[model samples]
Target: MNYKDLEFSTYPGFDEYILVKNLVDTPVKYKRGASYETIYNNEFNKWQDFFCQQYQVPAGKDVLLLHCCSWAKPYDFSIIINPIKQIADKYKNVHRVIMSNVGVVPYEFQMNETFCGYDFMNVDNEEKNVQEINHLYAKSLEERLFQYLESHIDRYKQVVLYSRPINMGNAPAVKNACERAGIPLIIEPNIDIYVKYRQKKYKQLDELFIEKECLDSLDKTLQLVGEKVGS
Candidate 1:
């Protein structure tokens, strides 16, 4: 299948649908080569510099940066995995950090991994770790957010942050930061197919439950109770 041939017009729908449907719509293929690493490293360096400059992070301050633990496999194999180290080394002001990545396990398990510092937020990855990371990402986000809020007001105030290739929902965590502080939240690849799938799936489940519980219950009652009364 030509995965690229999916009806998605690149409008950035949820990635879950895109990935689930990708196999059906197009063949899953990843390009491999040494040059892939070189190109990825270059891009990684550029993004690090961009985040540093964009935030005007002064030298020698603890930075609170959030980055995705996943990216294109090529990039992941090369540079996407080491953003915290990269920024910490590049900028002297980056003394401290708060970060997360998608999980490959359930949320409960992912939470422990996150607190232990595994920061793998690519929840969509077929890997158990990645899914586990994602499963616990939101809860972890809430935990980390509150921790940062509680301990380091000054540090959280000056955090030079970045999150991409992962989705943070439209919840109070994001909204509070936006409203309270002008911490600009940037979401790269604005597509949200996963969210759409979640919504659609919920609706289907609701309908099925109603059919099974209400409709089936009434039918069963009529068959059993009605027959008894008539007899």
Candidate 2:
């Protein structure tokens, strides 16, 4: 996929260019709710075997995994990392961890150098232009993510997704990807809990009310996805 040939609202950045590359590298047909039971089962075992062989790790070693969007806010950072931290501390031989996001890298994982080069929030342009750029960036992320999961579904031992349920950000794209790959997606329920906790602690109705809107947005998203698949 020559990204230059495609039209984007704004000029493509380094991160967007990489996403295009990844998308082109892994091509797969995506259909919502596609049955992949047999393929997924077979690939899951194969991936484990392949990784063990390649890395010379014991086949029995467990792999713990978690993921968050690159553009997640500070609050979301806490939500996603806390659980992973607890589990990693408790376990041994848990070698592989994966975080998927476009741009911003998690501070804890900065040494891993897995984050993209651009910052999604720092697009300096007119408000309307910025919105368009963000939309294009998100679309690129979604398409690249779908291709990535299709190619590497078996590589994951567990997939935990942390995102605001309302925003299409990475959750819907990841959900669709997992469904197509016949993988079970573990969604952290921390977002709702976090919002409620804040509301109670701060006693700020107006601010909390805005945060609580995510719950409704989440429901609407689920309904929309359900309707799409059902149709």
Candidate 3:
């Protein structure tokens, strides 16, 4: 079925309630009352794998990593677009990647029903126990993330997880993968600013990148890419 053909849902908990069953041709059945956050990813059954395969890095483009957000379209969020806009358009030759819980997603595929349709993005509380980091859930995601970075590291001219620099706000999985892969990661945002707004105004993972320093670093990185690409 076409993504455009899926009916719009105004579910109370999500921006849209697009059943994973409807998104793909393969049949899927979730357990009774399975929340998107706690749903077991039936990867071998072709559920999560299909979306993971959608990720791609364009030729000669740098890759920028961002965590998945509540909205179906990640770029629709201002924190994402604001920083992107500050960069040079020529150097803006970038592959915006969303480090989603189920899998990695390319920005171009954000509109794909497989990506934009579902609702499972509460990363800080991802583990079975919020205090425990050794759980299977977090381990699975980190394994996949490391594999993603390892496999795709050579594709882009540069891979950067350029986000708001916070002491702990950024995704450690991405940071560790980049570190393991030796990819350049520009993370030095204003923690004081992030802390100031994080408690009262921020409720989502993506919102943590809403810092001025992030925008400036991204602008410089893109400008440098532009210079390197001779655009």
Each prediction's Cα RMSD? 21.6, 15.4, 7.4
TM-scores, each model vs. reference: 0.32, 0.43, 0.61
lDDT of 1: 0.32
- CA lDDT of each prediction against the hidden true structure: 0.32, 0.38, 0.49
Arranged by lDDT with the best first, the candidates are: 3, 2, 1
Top candidate when judged by lDDT against the true structure: 3
> Candidate 1, residue 211: CA error in Å?
48
Winner of 1 and 3 under lDDT: 3
Among these predicted structures, which one has the highest TM-score?
A: 3
Candidate 1 lDDT over 126-154, as tens digits, reads 56454344335455445435433344444
Instruction: Name model 3 segments beyond 4 Å from true.
Output: 1-23, 27-40, 43-56, 72-90, 121-129, 132-138, 164-170, 188-208, 211-213, 225-230
* Weakest ten-residue segment in model 3 by summed lDDT: 28-37
Give me the runs in candidate 1 sitting further than 4 Å from their true place: 1-62, 70-78, 96-98, 101-136, 165-231
lDDT of 3 by residue, 81-183 (tens): 5455335334546655655444555555444444444554344455564434224434555566666666666665555565445424235666676677777
Q: Model 2 segments beyond 4 Å from truth?
A: 1-64, 69-118, 194-231
Model 1 RMSD in Å is: 21.6
Residue 120 shift from truth in candidate 1, angstroms: 5.6
